[model samples]
Target: MMFQLQIARIATAPLPVWIIWGLGLVTALLLFLSVLLHELGHSLVALHEGVKVRSITLCLFGGIAQTERDCPTAMASLRVAAAGPLVSLILSGLLLGFFPTTKSIHPLLGNLFGQLGALNLVLALFNLLPGLPLDGGLIIKALVWKITGSQRRGIQVANTTGRILSLTSIFAGIWLFLRGGGLSSLWLVMLGCFGLGATRNQSQILALQQVLRDLQVADAVNRRFRVLEDDQPLRRLSQIRLSSTADQRPANWVLVCRAGRWIGYLDDQPLRDLPVQQWDCQVVANHVRSLDELSCISDRAPLWQAVRALEHAHDGRLLVKNAAGIPCGTLDRCDLGEAVLHKLGVALPETFLAASRRQNAYPFGLALSQVVDSMTATDLTEDSV
Candidate 1:
């Protein structure tokens, strides 16, 4: 509807309704295409720097390019961040320059070119404002990273600046609204809110990442597993279950051994499949999985490594091993979250922990996978430098 009104205003003379609507549709598509091109510029530069582009998504706010990993150096990050705005600026220049030539051919074409060019210019300039989640913020992050030689410190600076800017923008929008600036002012408020929300989330994630870096996988391990002989009859499972209690519950996972050496694991499916009558005849040997099939993590590794490994695992679980390379226990997203909260001196109730475990999610609904990936990438970059 806004596009329709804008198109009607742009039309110098009365035209067919169909033609007006068609022009509006074309204009909208072209504007979005410009945004896509801008994001593409960033993706291409990142690719050239050996970063894999995961996806490019165009949204109502704008477009974003997600990379598989961070750039390995400050210079590479700067280049990747600047490419989008640079593309926008170039497009603006080309369109604005071509508008005059179109004016002599057709008035509508001239208006379209003029508006598009001006919009692109605004897009470029607006995104150049220094704040997190924006191209300019990334540039600032790169500069700080280069100067301090620490990506975490760079993120802290950028995020703090972004939060300040977001608050200022929100207030400015409210002032404008109070002064009768209307819907335009509302857009400003919305943008500011979005920025504030994004920055705050990033801040939390940063804090979590720092906690993970300071801790080890052993801190999050739950010794709720049992080691069973591969040759044991399936009836042993029923006995273990009957002997378990609330405080002394049996392991959810049962590791298998053959000839006193670790072999595989007993999956839950077979336990559910065999009835009481067949349990005595069935053996754990045939139902055991190979050791190589499990996702394993070392207790000596930092917690962030376990987070990343679990995020990529099919079951969202890890078999944890001690410093001696012997599997000691298991860790899941909930267990890891408990460790993090415990480190922060925050205690959760048993009910919340139980719910999180059932849902197979982190406590308090925290999302740590992406944060781990990002922080780990930054560590790699710092190590290389």
Candidate 2:
């Protein structure tokens, strides 16, 4: 009986499976190929506008064409942004036009062409919505930028509009769900959420870029920091306490030194775990991460460079050194948060200010207070002292 069932399955599966699989693979390939063509349209336009094309990538949803650098002008950006949608629209028109002719050839091929045409049309129209991270949003941004002469102002307007549109879509999705749309409504809601997130994220990225523009990491540096001898007797560590001076806030990091050189750093977490009795028996060198394992950035480097380092680093706090190869200070996301807020001209909220001042709760010192005024716990990590 099992053999009979298996034989039945094999006979039934071969024809339909092969045909469906072949058709499906061809359809998917064509869709991605169309996406690649759309991205190429953008890349070609970018090249025409004197912007260098880095690469064109076909993604699950669509495609992305990256430029080596931002377009030099608003008009240029607008042209580049519009190019992909224009290509999709053009492809849709061609497919629809040719679909009628394909009907005589084969039913499967005809249906496939019809579907592709419809999808391309939808893709073009959907992407035309004025939301950030979308082609239409870039067009809107370019238009706004051209009129206002400020790229930041353009991003603000486009992102605000995008958020509003996303909310509308979300509400519409909820309405659809109430009307028993089921999976379709859920899909709409997901798209709305994705759009909303993308818009906000792109806006924040623009803001961060502008705020950190031409700014070096040195501007946020606090010259007053503490260093410890790695070979020093651990019993003396109890005497070392954070000092709040008028000139500087407080030292966040205690750099470990060996032979008069900064070799590593003592982690405050492990030290706090030990009893007072064991302090004398342990050496400071044994409790610290070696310099080789530490992430270091130059004081002269840009704030963005430090940010990139911190993003990929195991520790949030970086060992910042001066041109003289001496440890000047530590750079953390907190400092960046403070600087970003200062750059954006936003006043620190009272509640946030109060929380950052709680030194005992966090790893670092009072300098963190300045940043806590502007940044949240998500922006900075409490991995170091």
- Top TM-score model: 1
RMSD of each: 4.4, 11.1
Q: Write down the lDDT that model 2 would get.
A: 0.69
**Structural RMSD, model 1:** 4.4
Give each model a TM-score. Answer: 0.81, 0.60
lDDT of each: 0.83, 0.69
Clashes per model (N, Cα, C within 3 A): 0, 1
* Top lDDT hit: 1
Candidate 2 backbone collisions, by pair: 252-385
Off by over 4 Å in 2: 1-15, 210-219, 225-385
Error in Å for residue 47 of model 2:
1.8
71-181 in candidate 2: lDDT tens per residue? 777898899899999999999999989887885676555667777887788888887898877888889989998888766567677888889889889999999999999
